[model samples]
Target: MAGAETTRDPYAGKSPAAPLWTADFRFFFTARTTSLLGDAMLPVAITAAVLHAGYGASGVGYALAALVAPFAALIIFGGVLSDRFGARLLMVVSDAARLVFQLVLALLFLLGTPALWQILALLALVGAGSAVFQPGVASVTPRVARDVQKANATLRVSESVTLVLGPSLAGLLLAVSSPAAVVALDALTYGVSGVCLLLLRAVPMGPGPERDGAPSFRADLVEGWREFTARTWLWSVIVVFMLWQLAGAGPATTLGNSTLVTDYGSSTFGLVMSAFGAGSVLGGLVAIRLRPRYPLRAGALSMTVWALMPLGVALGLAAPLVAVCYGISGVGGAFWIVMFHTSVQTHVPQEVLGRVHAYDAAGSLVMKPVGQAAAGPLAGVAGTVPLLFVSSAMAVVTCVLLLALPAVRGLTRAER
Candidate 1:
């Protein structure tokens, strides 16, 4: 299954002969960009409010756990529902629901102090919406754009832009206004995205109908799982990705950020992050033009760049040196994301793409929180530097070894 190629796209001849940015694709792109912009701004405002209002550090942890819980729990269900109802329909509904939740949370912050549980519940609502929205978008992109690679690159560039702007905008607003304003602004973006999602007319190719008279949800889940596992290259890379995520996400992202701030100071940390953002933008722009033929293999190679982050920290590099390493990794990350998504969109059949994406999301994320939760305690015993070293080794080894198989090595882009 790894080297398998489809003879024809299901939606062949449907793509417009014009450039990538057709009317419907533009609307779809706008919807995703606006949503990401809001998501980018959200964490800073939430953290500021939680800390400033005396929710304390534990409250932030609790908030993240609350958000992750429902998202993980409902993500598969979201995929099934999206497949049944159509991507645009599900996305619009999800956005509308998130919009309401954000508005309510904003009102609570503006008017009175909501209990921690209440805030968590609202955040969970948002996460659920996110879970539902993600798979649909993955399924929808190939349908929306004539060139999936460029489309994915454009989205990644928008993400890079928002990464620079979102936090800055939130910080600026917090200086002059309240967290409620930030949350309200996020709600407004959701409204805009929802309206845009509702307007998409390009993707008439929805998912297949039910298997029998009334297929159980469990049956659908099984079918998706079978499809996912049918491709060894797909599952093998996922297992490798899961391992690296387990190692890097918590230890590298959660604990590593803390270490950077402690050792180099906030200013240095900001500089390093800014470099990463700039690199991501550059990567996205380059990827728009440089569409690699063997996207899956190239993408896997790019992910190995993440090893530099932990390696830089473990070696006690200077602030600028660490920044440069992370910046390179950021470029690699954008390239990897664009290539990976494009490969999935081009290779996977349209009917089951949503469900498969859900599994992909689940596999990639399932260990991240566990890693986050365990990193602090584990580091206390092993020390952060040693664990950082381990994380780097795991990334390099997993990727390099996976390349030995022909399945991973030989896979190419679908014929247009």
Candidate 2:
């Protein structure tokens, strides 16, 4: 049903307007970009707040984990609900919930020192909201845009811009005002995003007939699993990403941060990350222009670049050199994301798309915390440099194996 042509063109036979000019898409873009801005600011503000409140690094870690762990745990349920009730409704509910929690947290922050547990609890609620928000947002796009590729590219470009600017804006705000102010602003943005969702008039109710008599929760999950596992290419790439992410997360995040701070300084590390974000912008721009014949192949090949960041670090390269590598990886990562999402939207049936996406996200990220948890101990035992090298090599190997799979390399784009 995803790629299938219907008698009714959702765009209503009008000539394709620029993605930004399409009313529904325009609203969606504005909402997402505004929300991303807040998300980008949140980590910095929260970390600073925790430290200022006299919590140590471990407190920061637990606080961050509280946000991510529940997000991963509940995402599959979110997907099922999105497919069941409709993306629009789920998005509205999710944003509203987030808005309430963020406002509460901001108020608490303003009142004085809040306990660590209170902060973690609030963050966990926000994360639960995200679990619903993500699938709803992703699943709604195909319905809103006539040209999925261009739409995705446009969205990625907006996200890239947000990533490039949000943290810098947060830092400046923190320098002048307080973390409470930043969080209050974030709460305000969530309210804005909720209003935008209410304004969106054209998003489809997912998987029409199948959703008529909604199955039991367990049955819905089982059906989603069947859809996810039915496609060879889909599962293969997901598996590859799980392995690749598992290998890279620790090295890129924990080790990279530690090594850079020790060898260079926080400023240099920030510059390197900024370069990576810039590369993602470049990649999104390039994706808008290039329509690869074999999208899956292209995406898989692009992933080979991911190995370079760890390799550069393993070689004990200078910060600028390692930054260059990170930049390249960012480009590849952006390309892969655009292509991968497009492929899935095209190939997967619309009714089950949200569930499949949830599975994809869950599988890809389920191991990240494990990798983060293991990285420190592993580094202690095996040494950081060697662990980084091993991760780099594993990344390359994973890319090669994915490319070698007939299912991955041979899949073509679905007809529009």
Candidate 3:
């Protein structure tokens, strides 16, 4: 009788178990994490390969740029495809494509027949494939989530776990043999992820063309844009994110890795990266217990942690100190990622989820190549340390901007 007196749960409309434990969620989650590990490993391995091949910082810059170049040109198309065809097929196909590309790279590297142009070409292909995989994976989460917050937390865990293992494993592979062998390991991971994805058997839920009359591509794109732009939280955060990417991610991905290669050996780079990954894992764990009253505020504040890395490096912090800086930053990044994705997953319409996610992807990543392309030549003129300083400062500014927006500062998770 007392049980009957209690009011029903507001979130009873959705499931109550954690999202990660669901069958579909577990399958896709594992597959994506495996693929992400492959992705993480490739950069470290490729960066090492280039340095070993006697390429300078400029060469490393171009290689990193190549990985992001296609995003500027083709990511919108990939997003549209995910919206049209659904995410599952796109993921399977992308993973299969990655497996093939990495396998070829591995063979070429192992045979000692590597060429800079060949590596760049392969990286471009993988980048193009990522254009499909990233949005596809993100859009699928709502279908399997118990709720938006749970979905976001689950995705964070997946990301953290992969980051934890990928770099360290890449370091091990690079140390034991060559970057080529590491590429081979990456290729195998792709294959495994693809197979696991094939075993996943859930039908996706989203809007598509009407049976009576199909909308034209242009109209569909317009609808997607409307959905994406209509949400202040969605576009505002991403606009800030785009600026942050241009100011920080490009430099960090390219120069940061290079700095480790030049200042520290491959083993040390691996350890620093492993520390970063470990920190992300810890952040994800913390996120599980944290139902922040202000999700967006928490997310914004967490991002400020990134500034520490460049400051540490600029202060000539070395070895373990550098590692610690990255670790702290990684934890912050993980928290922000969880909050941001949860915001999108929960707030956006399920029907237009793919299209909106596509728009988000395009918005968040559009400037990344610009940053990547500039890092090489800029570092040449300004010096790496100065460039790192400028980028870190910009990130801090972006984080501060988050405090001004009431929408973000006072956001909260839906209650059960």
lDDT of 2: 0.82
Model 3 misplaced stretches (Cα beyond 4 Å): 1-12, 15-19, 44-64, 104-122, 174-182, 205-213, 249-269, 372-389
Q: Select the stronger candidate by TM-score from 1 and 3.
A: 1
Give the better candidate number (1 or 3) by lDDT.
1
Range of the 10 consecutive residues with the lowest summed lDDT in candidate 1:
1-10
Error of 2 at 248 (Å): 2.9
Better of 2 and 3 by TM-score: 2
**Model 2 — TM-score against the truth?**
0.94
* Model 1 stretches with alpha carbons more than 4 Å out: 1-11, 14-18, 205-214
TM-score of each: 0.93, 0.94, 0.82
Best model per lDDT: 2
Report the candidate with higher lDDT, 1 versus 2. 2
Candidate 2 on 71-135: residue-level lDDT in tens? Answer: 99999999998988887888888888998998888888889988989999999999999999898
Which is the leading candidate under TM-score? Answer: 2
Go through the candidates in order and give each one's C-alpha lDDT: 0.81, 0.82, 0.74
